[model samples]
Target: MNASTTGLRRGLQTAAVGSAAAIALGFFSAGAANADTLVPLPDGSITETLVDGTVVTITRTGETANISPSMGSTPLHRNVWVSGSTKVEVSNGGSGTIQPGYIVACQLTLGGKSGTDGGMSTTWADPDGAAKQTAKTAGNLSIGPGQAVDYKILDLELADPFGAEQHRAANPYKGKGSVTWADSTLGVSGCAGYAQARSYVKVTVNTANVTGNVTLWGQPFSIG
Candidate 1:
Protein backbone atom coordinates (compact mmCIF):
# COMPACT_ATOMS: atom_id res chain seq x y z
CA MET A 1 0.00 0.00 0.00
CA ASN A 2 1.07 3.65 -0.49
CA ALA A 3 2.34 5.47 2.63
CA SER A 4 -0.57 7.96 2.77
CA THR A 5 -3.26 5.23 2.38
CA THR A 6 -1.61 3.04 5.08
CA GLY A 7 -1.63 5.91 7.59
CA LEU A 8 -5.31 6.67 6.93
CA ARG A 9 -6.32 3.01 7.44
CA ARG A 10 -4.49 2.84 10.78
CA GLY A 11 -6.15 6.09 11.96
CA LEU A 12 -9.63 4.81 11.08
CA GLN A 13 -8.99 1.48 12.86
CA THR A 14 -7.86 3.30 16.04
CA ALA A 15 -10.93 5.53 16.03
CA ALA A 16 -13.26 2.52 15.65
CA VAL A 17 -11.68 0.68 18.57
CA GLY A 18 -11.86 3.77 20.76
CA SER A 19 -15.55 4.26 20.05
CA ALA A 20 -16.35 0.61 20.77
CA ALA A 21 -14.51 0.76 24.11
CA ALA A 22 -16.39 3.93 25.13
CA ILE A 23 -19.73 2.34 24.28
CA ALA A 24 -18.96 -0.76 26.31
CA LEU A 25 -17.96 1.32 29.33
CA GLY A 26 -21.17 3.32 29.11
CA PHE A 27 -23.29 0.18 28.92
CA PHE A 28 -21.75 -1.29 32.05
CA SER A 29 -21.96 1.98 33.95
CA ALA A 30 -25.66 2.36 33.21
CA GLY A 31 -26.37 -1.22 34.20
CA ALA A 32 -24.69 -0.71 37.55
CA ALA A 33 -25.89 2.81 38.30
CA ASN A 34 -29.43 3.16 36.96
CA ALA A 35 -30.88 -0.30 37.37
CA ASP A 36 -34.61 -0.17 38.21
CA THR A 37 -36.99 -2.79 39.55
CA LEU A 38 -40.71 -3.11 38.92
CA VAL A 39 -42.85 -5.27 41.16
CA PRO A 40 -46.47 -6.33 40.78
CA LEU A 41 -48.05 -6.91 44.19
CA PRO A 42 -50.83 -9.22 45.14
CA ASP A 43 -54.24 -8.04 46.31
CA GLY A 44 -55.09 -7.91 50.01
CA SER A 45 -58.47 -8.31 51.72
CA ILE A 46 -59.88 -8.55 55.21
CA THR A 47 -63.34 -8.84 56.73
CA GLU A 48 -64.34 -8.23 60.31
CA THR A 49 -67.37 -7.60 62.50
CA LEU A 50 -67.43 -4.59 64.78
CA VAL A 51 -68.70 -4.51 68.32
CA ASP A 52 -72.16 -3.53 67.19
CA GLY A 53 -72.44 -6.30 64.61
CA THR A 54 -71.38 -4.07 61.75
CA VAL A 55 -69.69 -6.07 59.01
CA VAL A 56 -66.75 -4.22 57.47
CA THR A 57 -64.81 -5.42 54.45
CA ILE A 58 -61.67 -3.69 53.21
CA THR A 59 -59.75 -4.53 50.03
CA ARG A 60 -56.75 -3.29 48.09
CA THR A 61 -56.23 -4.12 44.43
CA GLY A 62 -54.17 -3.22 41.32
CA GLU A 63 -51.11 -2.57 43.48
CA THR A 64 -47.64 -2.01 42.01
CA ALA A 65 -44.30 -0.55 42.99
CA ASN A 66 -41.67 0.98 40.73
CA ILE A 67 -38.41 1.23 42.63
CA SER A 68 -35.57 3.25 41.15
CA PRO A 69 -32.17 4.53 42.08
CA SER A 70 -32.20 7.19 44.75
CA MET A 71 -32.14 10.84 43.91
CA GLY A 72 -29.46 11.23 46.52
CA SER A 73 -27.32 8.72 44.56
CA THR A 74 -26.26 6.98 47.75
CA PRO A 75 -27.06 3.86 49.68
CA LEU A 76 -28.87 5.89 52.32
CA HIS A 77 -31.50 7.16 49.90
CA ARG A 78 -34.37 5.37 48.10
CA ASN A 79 -37.26 6.42 45.86
CA VAL A 80 -40.44 4.65 44.82
CA TRP A 81 -43.66 5.28 42.92
CA VAL A 82 -46.68 3.30 44.08
CA SER A 83 -50.20 2.86 42.71
CA GLY A 84 -53.25 1.16 44.21
CA SER A 85 -56.92 1.46 45.10
CA THR A 86 -58.59 1.01 48.47
CA LYS A 87 -62.22 0.02 48.81
CA VAL A 88 -64.40 -0.11 51.91
CA GLU A 89 -67.83 -1.65 52.44
CA VAL A 90 -69.84 -1.41 55.59
CA SER A 91 -72.92 -3.56 56.00
CA ASN A 92 -76.25 -2.72 57.66
CA GLY A 93 -76.56 0.75 56.13
CA GLY A 94 -73.61 2.27 57.95
CA SER A 95 -71.50 5.36 57.21
CA GLY A 96 -67.78 5.71 57.61
CA THR A 97 -64.50 7.37 56.63
CA ILE A 98 -61.64 5.78 54.67
CA GLN A 99 -57.97 6.55 55.21
CA PRO A 100 -55.49 5.03 52.76
CA GLY A 101 -51.76 5.10 53.39
CA TYR A 102 -48.45 3.23 53.28
CA ILE A 103 -45.98 1.97 55.85
CA VAL A 104 -42.25 2.04 55.04
CA ALA A 105 -39.73 0.05 57.03
CA CYS A 106 -36.07 -0.72 57.05
CA GLN A 107 -34.96 -4.13 58.34
CA LEU A 108 -38.29 -4.74 59.96
CA THR A 109 -40.99 -7.36 59.43
CA LEU A 110 -44.25 -5.64 58.59
CA GLY A 111 -47.71 -7.20 58.74
CA GLY A 112 -48.79 -10.13 60.95
CA LYS A 113 -46.00 -9.44 63.41
CA SER A 114 -46.35 -8.13 66.97
CA GLY A 115 -44.48 -4.97 67.77
CA THR A 116 -43.32 -3.22 70.93
CA ASP A 117 -45.21 -2.76 74.20
CA GLY A 118 -47.32 0.36 74.74
CA GLY A 119 -48.55 3.75 73.54
CA MET A 120 -48.27 4.65 69.85
CA SER A 121 -45.05 2.67 69.69
CA THR A 122 -46.92 -0.60 69.98
CA THR A 123 -48.06 -2.72 67.05
CA TRP A 124 -51.13 -4.79 67.78
CA ALA A 125 -53.39 -7.07 65.76
CA ASP A 126 -57.10 -6.89 65.23
CA PRO A 127 -59.59 -9.74 65.43
CA ASP A 128 -59.26 -10.20 61.69
CA GLY A 129 -55.47 -10.80 61.84
CA ALA A 130 -54.37 -7.39 60.65
CA ALA A 131 -51.56 -5.48 62.28
CA LYS A 132 -52.13 -1.94 63.58
CA GLN A 133 -49.61 0.87 63.62
CA THR A 134 -49.44 4.53 64.59
CA ALA A 135 -47.10 7.42 63.76
CA LYS A 136 -48.58 8.79 60.55
CA THR A 137 -47.58 11.93 58.61
CA ALA A 138 -48.14 13.63 55.27
CA GLY A 139 -44.63 15.04 54.80
CA ASN A 140 -41.12 13.75 54.43
CA LEU A 141 -39.92 11.07 56.83
CA SER A 142 -36.62 9.60 58.00
CA ILE A 143 -35.98 6.35 59.82
CA GLY A 144 -33.05 4.27 61.00
CA PRO A 145 -32.51 0.56 60.78
CA GLY A 146 -35.29 -1.58 62.30
CA GLN A 147 -37.70 1.35 62.14
CA ALA A 148 -40.86 2.12 60.19
CA VAL A 149 -43.12 5.12 59.48
CA ASP A 150 -46.63 5.61 58.14
CA TYR A 151 -47.73 8.27 55.65
CA LYS A 152 -51.01 9.26 54.09
CA ILE A 153 -51.49 8.79 50.36
CA LEU A 154 -53.61 11.89 49.98
CA ASP A 155 -52.99 15.49 51.16
CA LEU A 156 -56.24 17.10 49.95
CA GLU A 157 -56.02 20.79 50.69
CA LEU A 158 -59.02 23.00 51.39
CA ALA A 159 -59.80 26.28 53.12
CA ASP A 160 -61.70 26.40 56.33
CA PRO A 161 -64.41 28.96 57.13
CA PHE A 162 -61.79 31.23 58.73
CA GLY A 163 -59.81 31.46 55.46
CA ALA A 164 -57.04 29.16 56.69
CA GLU A 165 -55.43 26.30 54.79
CA GLN A 166 -56.30 22.85 56.08
CA HIS A 167 -55.14 19.40 54.97
CA ARG A 168 -57.70 16.62 54.83
CA ALA A 169 -56.15 13.14 54.84
CA ALA A 170 -59.27 11.03 54.77
CA ASN A 171 -62.54 10.82 52.90
CA PRO A 172 -66.03 10.15 54.22
CA TYR A 173 -68.66 7.95 52.67
CA LYS A 174 -72.03 6.51 53.46
CA GLY A 175 -72.21 2.71 53.31
CA LYS A 176 -69.34 2.42 50.79
CA GLY A 177 -66.16 4.34 50.11
CA SER A 178 -63.50 3.95 47.41
CA VAL A 179 -60.22 5.75 46.69
CA THR A 180 -57.62 5.25 43.93
CA TRP A 181 -54.12 6.69 43.70
CA ALA A 182 -51.49 6.71 40.91
CA ASP A 183 -47.85 7.73 40.66
CA SER A 184 -47.70 8.49 44.38
CA THR A 185 -44.19 9.29 45.53
CA LEU A 186 -42.75 7.62 48.63
CA GLY A 187 -39.16 8.36 49.48
CA VAL A 188 -36.87 7.14 52.25
CA SER A 189 -33.68 8.70 53.47
CA GLY A 190 -30.98 7.82 56.03
CA CYS A 191 -31.59 4.12 55.82
CA ALA A 192 -28.41 2.07 55.63
CA GLY A 193 -30.20 -1.20 55.06
CA TYR A 194 -32.76 -2.80 52.78
CA ALA A 195 -36.16 -1.12 52.70
CA GLN A 196 -39.74 -2.33 52.24
CA ALA A 197 -43.23 -0.86 52.01
CA ARG A 198 -46.83 -2.03 52.36
CA SER A 199 -50.26 -0.50 51.82
CA TYR A 200 -52.90 -0.06 54.55
CA VAL A 201 -56.51 1.10 54.56
CA LYS A 202 -58.16 2.25 57.76
CA VAL A 203 -61.92 2.66 58.00
CA THR A 204 -63.79 4.26 60.83
CA VAL A 205 -67.45 3.34 60.80
CA ASN A 206 -70.35 4.85 62.73
CA THR A 207 -73.40 2.71 63.21
CA ALA A 208 -76.50 3.14 65.34
CA ASN A 209 -74.90 1.08 68.10
CA VAL A 210 -71.20 1.92 68.17
CA THR A 211 -68.20 3.46 66.43
CA GLY A 212 -65.27 1.27 65.45
CA ASN A 213 -62.05 1.17 63.44
CA VAL A 214 -61.10 -1.51 60.93
CA THR A 215 -57.75 -1.65 59.17
CA LEU A 216 -56.58 -3.84 56.29
CA TRP A 217 -52.94 -4.38 55.30
CA GLY A 218 -51.34 -5.27 51.96
CA GLN A 219 -48.36 -7.50 51.31
CA PRO A 220 -44.93 -6.01 51.79
CA PHE A 221 -42.55 -5.39 48.84
CA SER A 222 -38.91 -4.44 48.66
CA ILE A 223 -37.74 -0.98 47.55
CA GLY A 224 -34.13 -1.47 46.57
Candidate 2:
Protein backbone atom coordinates (compact mmCIF):
# COMPACT_ATOMS: atom_id res chain seq x y z
CA MET A 1 0.00 0.00 0.00
CA ASN A 2 1.08 3.60 -0.54
CA ALA A 3 2.41 5.45 2.51
CA SER A 4 -0.57 7.87 2.65
CA THR A 5 -3.10 5.04 2.22
CA THR A 6 -1.52 3.02 5.00
CA GLY A 7 -1.65 6.01 7.41
CA LEU A 8 -5.32 6.69 6.58
CA ARG A 9 -6.25 3.03 7.23
CA ARG A 10 -4.48 3.11 10.59
CA GLY A 11 -6.34 6.32 11.56
CA LEU A 12 -9.69 4.73 10.61
CA GLN A 13 -8.95 1.71 12.78
CA THR A 14 -8.14 3.94 15.74
CA ALA A 15 -11.39 5.91 15.29
CA ALA A 16 -13.47 2.70 15.23
CA VAL A 17 -11.85 1.45 18.41
CA GLY A 18 -12.49 4.76 20.17
CA SER A 19 -16.16 4.77 19.10
CA ALA A 20 -16.67 1.21 20.40
CA ALA A 21 -15.09 2.13 23.73
CA ALA A 22 -17.36 5.19 24.05
CA ILE A 23 -20.49 3.08 23.43
CA ALA A 24 -19.43 0.52 26.00
CA LEU A 25 -18.78 3.25 28.55
CA GLY A 26 -22.28 4.68 27.96
CA PHE A 27 -23.89 1.30 28.51
CA PHE A 28 -22.02 0.88 31.75
CA SER A 29 -23.06 4.29 33.01
CA ALA A 30 -26.73 3.64 32.19
CA GLY A 31 -26.71 0.33 34.00
CA ALA A 32 -25.23 1.98 37.07
CA ALA A 33 -27.92 4.67 37.06
CA ASN A 34 -30.69 2.10 36.78
CA ALA A 35 -29.31 0.14 39.66
CA ASP A 36 -29.24 3.18 41.90
CA THR A 37 -32.82 4.20 41.19
CA LEU A 38 -35.18 3.70 44.14
CA VAL A 39 -37.91 1.13 43.89
CA PRO A 40 -41.51 1.29 45.18
CA LEU A 41 -42.40 -0.49 48.38
CA PRO A 42 -43.00 -4.23 48.06
CA ASP A 43 -46.49 -5.68 48.14
CA GLY A 44 -48.07 -5.68 51.61
CA SER A 45 -45.93 -2.78 52.82
CA ILE A 46 -47.76 -0.26 55.01
CA THR A 47 -46.05 2.83 53.63
CA GLU A 48 -47.02 4.06 50.18
CA THR A 49 -46.36 7.01 47.87
CA LEU A 50 -49.23 8.28 45.80
CA VAL A 51 -48.45 9.07 42.16
CA ASP A 52 -48.56 12.75 41.28
CA GLY A 53 -52.15 13.88 40.89
CA THR A 54 -53.23 10.58 42.41
CA VAL A 55 -55.34 10.50 45.55
CA VAL A 56 -55.06 7.73 48.15
CA THR A 57 -58.22 7.37 50.17
CA ILE A 58 -58.04 5.45 53.46
CA THR A 59 -61.49 4.83 54.89
CA ARG A 60 -61.64 3.80 58.56
CA THR A 61 -64.59 1.53 59.03
CA GLY A 62 -66.48 0.35 62.19
CA GLU A 63 -67.89 1.32 65.58
CA THR A 64 -65.14 1.28 68.16
CA ALA A 65 -65.64 3.18 71.38
CA ASN A 66 -62.69 4.91 72.99
CA ILE A 67 -64.34 5.27 76.39
CA SER A 68 -62.91 7.27 79.27
CA PRO A 69 -64.31 8.94 82.36
CA SER A 70 -65.68 12.37 81.46
CA MET A 71 -63.26 13.50 84.19
CA GLY A 72 -60.14 11.78 82.91
CA SER A 73 -57.93 12.10 79.82
CA THR A 74 -56.61 9.57 77.29
CA PRO A 75 -54.52 9.61 74.10
CA LEU A 76 -55.77 8.25 70.77
CA HIS A 77 -52.92 7.17 68.51
CA ARG A 78 -52.47 6.39 64.78
CA ASN A 79 -49.73 6.57 62.11
CA VAL A 80 -50.37 8.61 58.96
CA TRP A 81 -48.47 10.65 56.35
CA VAL A 82 -48.42 14.33 55.48
CA SER A 83 -47.25 15.06 51.98
CA GLY A 84 -49.40 17.19 49.70
CA SER A 85 -52.53 18.45 51.46
CA THR A 86 -54.83 16.13 53.40
CA LYS A 87 -58.51 16.35 54.26
CA VAL A 88 -59.75 14.55 57.38
CA GLU A 89 -63.36 13.83 58.26
CA VAL A 90 -64.35 12.59 61.75
CA SER A 91 -67.81 11.21 62.44
CA ASN A 92 -69.07 10.70 66.01
CA GLY A 93 -71.42 7.86 66.77
CA GLY A 94 -73.21 7.10 70.07
CA SER A 95 -74.28 8.75 73.36
CA GLY A 96 -72.37 9.92 76.40
CA THR A 97 -72.87 11.81 79.61
CA ILE A 98 -71.08 15.08 80.42
CA GLN A 99 -71.98 15.81 84.02
CA PRO A 100 -72.30 19.30 85.43
CA GLY A 101 -69.14 21.24 86.41
CA TYR A 102 -67.03 19.05 84.09
CA ILE A 103 -65.14 20.07 80.94
CA VAL A 104 -64.24 17.79 78.01
CA ALA A 105 -62.59 18.56 74.70
CA CYS A 106 -60.93 16.91 71.66
CA GLN A 107 -57.27 17.42 70.81
CA LEU A 108 -55.00 16.57 67.85
CA THR A 109 -51.22 16.38 67.67
CA LEU A 110 -48.86 16.44 64.65
CA GLY A 111 -45.37 15.14 65.44
CA GLY A 112 -42.18 16.11 63.64
CA LYS A 113 -39.96 13.73 61.67
CA SER A 114 -39.46 11.87 64.93
CA GLY A 115 -43.15 11.21 65.61
CA THR A 116 -45.04 12.43 68.71
CA ASP A 117 -43.07 14.55 71.20
CA GLY A 118 -40.85 15.44 68.23
CA GLY A 119 -43.03 18.08 66.53
CA MET A 120 -45.78 20.70 67.06
CA SER A 121 -49.38 20.43 68.23
CA THR A 122 -52.55 22.36 67.47
CA THR A 123 -55.98 22.34 69.24
CA TRP A 124 -59.49 23.25 68.01
CA ALA A 125 -62.67 24.05 69.95
CA ASP A 126 -65.42 26.59 70.35
CA PRO A 127 -64.57 29.76 72.23
CA ASP A 128 -66.51 30.84 75.26
CA GLY A 129 -67.74 34.41 74.93
CA ALA A 130 -69.39 36.57 77.62
CA ALA A 131 -71.13 33.57 79.15
CA LYS A 132 -69.32 31.95 82.08
CA GLN A 133 -70.37 28.52 80.74
CA THR A 134 -70.15 27.22 77.18
CA ALA A 135 -72.37 24.39 76.04
CA LYS A 136 -71.52 22.16 73.07
CA THR A 137 -73.80 19.59 71.51
CA ALA A 138 -73.33 16.91 68.90
CA GLY A 139 -76.80 15.56 67.95
CA ASN A 140 -79.86 15.07 70.13
CA LEU A 141 -77.73 15.29 73.30
CA SER A 142 -77.26 18.42 75.37
CA ILE A 143 -73.75 19.18 76.57
CA GLY A 144 -74.75 20.99 79.80
CA PRO A 145 -75.26 18.96 82.93
CA GLY A 146 -78.55 17.11 83.82
CA GLN A 147 -78.81 15.70 80.27
CA ALA A 148 -77.34 13.05 77.93
CA VAL A 149 -75.90 14.04 74.52
CA ASP A 150 -75.60 12.24 71.20
CA TYR A 151 -73.58 14.03 68.54
CA LYS A 152 -71.01 13.90 65.75
CA ILE A 153 -68.08 16.14 64.94
CA LEU A 154 -67.92 16.54 61.16
CA ASP A 155 -65.47 17.50 58.38
CA LEU A 156 -62.17 18.54 59.95
CA GLU A 157 -59.65 19.51 57.24
CA LEU A 158 -55.86 19.83 57.50
CA ALA A 159 -53.39 20.82 54.77
CA ASP A 160 -49.73 19.71 54.98
CA PRO A 161 -47.23 20.90 52.38
CA PHE A 162 -43.55 20.38 51.72
CA GLY A 163 -41.06 22.54 53.70
CA ALA A 164 -43.07 21.71 56.82
CA GLU A 165 -40.87 19.44 58.93
CA GLN A 166 -42.11 15.88 58.88
CA HIS A 167 -43.71 14.83 62.18
CA ARG A 168 -41.97 11.45 62.11
CA ALA A 169 -39.06 9.99 60.16
CA ALA A 170 -40.64 9.07 56.82
CA ASN A 171 -39.22 6.80 54.15
CA PRO A 172 -38.85 9.07 51.12
CA TYR A 173 -40.59 6.25 49.26
CA LYS A 174 -41.45 3.46 51.71
CA GLY A 175 -42.16 4.42 55.39
CA LYS A 176 -45.15 5.38 57.48
CA GLY A 177 -46.20 8.75 59.00
CA SER A 178 -47.60 9.28 62.49
CA VAL A 179 -50.83 10.94 63.71
CA THR A 180 -52.71 10.94 67.05
CA TRP A 181 -56.15 11.95 68.33
CA ALA A 182 -57.37 12.24 71.89
CA ASP A 183 -60.16 13.65 74.05
CA SER A 184 -59.35 16.03 76.87
CA THR A 185 -60.69 15.79 80.40
CA LEU A 186 -59.08 18.99 81.58
CA GLY A 187 -62.11 20.51 83.36
CA VAL A 188 -64.58 17.70 83.89
CA SER A 189 -65.25 17.95 87.63
CA GLY A 190 -68.00 15.41 88.09
CA CYS A 191 -67.27 11.91 89.43
CA ALA A 192 -66.04 9.35 86.90
CA GLY A 193 -68.70 8.75 84.23
CA TYR A 194 -68.52 6.85 80.95
CA ALA A 195 -68.77 8.79 77.65
CA GLN A 196 -69.26 6.75 74.47
CA ALA A 197 -67.15 8.05 71.57
CA ARG A 198 -66.62 6.65 68.06
CA SER A 199 -64.78 8.25 65.18
CA TYR A 200 -63.70 7.39 61.60
CA VAL A 201 -61.02 9.36 59.77
CA LYS A 202 -59.99 9.29 56.09
CA VAL A 203 -56.74 10.80 54.81
CA THR A 204 -55.48 11.46 51.27
CA VAL A 205 -51.72 12.06 50.84
CA ASN A 206 -50.17 14.02 47.99
CA THR A 207 -47.34 12.62 45.91
CA ALA A 208 -43.80 13.85 45.31
CA ASN A 209 -40.27 12.65 44.44
CA VAL A 210 -39.71 11.19 47.92
CA THR A 211 -37.44 8.22 47.20
CA GLY A 212 -36.82 5.10 49.37
CA ASN A 213 -38.93 3.07 51.79
CA VAL A 214 -41.13 4.50 54.59
CA THR A 215 -43.07 3.04 57.56
CA LEU A 216 -45.79 4.26 59.98
CA TRP A 217 -45.60 3.43 63.69
CA GLY A 218 -48.02 4.08 66.56
CA GLN A 219 -50.21 2.34 69.14
CA PRO A 220 -52.88 0.66 67.04
CA PHE A 221 -56.37 1.50 68.25
CA SER A 222 -59.72 0.46 66.81
CA ILE A 223 -60.37 1.31 63.11
CA GLY A 224 -63.76 0.22 61.86
Top model number, lDDT:
1
Per-residue CA lDDT of model 2 for 82-155, tens digit only, reads: 11111222112111111111222222223212212321112112112111233343211222222222122222
Q: State each model's CA lDDT, in order.
A: 0.77, 0.27
Q: Which runs of model 1 end up more than 4 angstroms from their true locations?
A: 1-28, 31-33, 108-139
Q: In model 1, where is the ten-residue run with the lowest total lDDT?
A: 118-127
Error of 1 at 94 (Å): 1.5
lDDT of 1 by residue, 45-127 (tens): 99999887889999999999888887788888988888999888899889978988887766543442234321112332432
List TM-scores for all candidates, in order.
Answer: 0.74, 0.20
The Cα RMSD of model 1 versus the native structure comes to 6.7
Best by TM-score: 1
